[model samples]
Target: MMAGPRPNALSWLGLSAVLVAVDQWSKWLAVSRLEYGNPVPFIDGFWNWTLVHNYGAAFSFLSSAGGWQRWFFTALAIVISTGLVVWLARTPRSDWRSALPFALIIAGAIGNVIDRIRYGYVVDFVDWYVGTWHWPAFNVADSAIVVGAALLVVLSFKSPDTTGKGG
Candidate 1:
């Protein structure tokens, strides 16, 4: 009889849970404590807490598309989250480099999905950049997704499994 594949060591689900909790808590704080567009400086020139609602994808991609984007984004998020969960389950726990990113993406997707389902948009804050060239406002969930993507890109290049090697 062959033994089952070794289970993953890292808890991708647990990491995802933590990301969701932190992301939601941060959004709650932003909504309750800050008024929209009003900057509450946290680092004077580097960071600020400014509440904003995004009705579309990254950088407000479809925010001005007249309103069809709400459902579109919602559906996309659902699909992405589902796919991430499935991938995470199949990934070995020892593959933290890959699994963590998937977990973060999953958490971020679910977090934004909650907002879209509840308010038809995602709440964003934590602004950064120079005086006239400000980056789009975003929340903890967005941050996780971006960081996770970057990490995934880096890991893909480093991992032989991802690079398609066999011996």
Candidate 2:
């Protein structure tokens, strides 16, 4: 007997769309309701809703590099997101381990790219801190990227199944 056609993970794009919508909506809310550079406390000395803009990559890397970084980052995001989308199309539908991460990273990359193209900067609002030490302010897209990348890293270490059973 011949094997039938295999299902692809393209359906998981729905998750990406939902995530992008939520990311964009959150950024819109932050822009509309919060004042730039001001911290609105969400938790006592631990968290805040602070509106800020980042012109570069993670943790504001290269953010101050004269005007070119905006287009550079935007193009980079487009390329990365495009590649992941292609990967998603090739992935098997049953491989949630791979599909989930690809979907999340795609959503995040596209989400930030939209901001960069429209506003010349990525909108950031969430702020976490401890005492005087503070982590960088980031948005929903950044969170998704972080989680997705982390999952990819963790899953990469899974040992192969020895019993010939697909895992």
Predictions in order: lDDT: 0.85, 0.92
Instruction: For candidate 1, report its TM-score.
Output: 0.90
User: Residue-wise lDDT of candidate 1 within 17-127, one digit each (tens)?
Assistant: 888899999999998999988999998888889999998999999998887898898899889888887777777766777787888888888889889888888999989
lDDT per residue as tens, model 2, 1-167: 99997889899999999999999999999999999999999998899999999998999999999979999988888898889888888987877788899899989999999999999999999999999998999998999999999999998898545454678
- Scored by TM-score, the top model is 2
How many backbone collisions does model 2 have? 0
Query: Over 4 Å off in model 1, which ranges?
Result: 160-167
Q: How many residue pairs clash in each candidate?
A: 2, 0
Per-model RMSD to reference = 3.5, 2.1
Q: Which 10-residue window in model 2 sums to the lowest lDDT? A: 158-167
Worst 10 residues of 1 by lDDT: 158-167
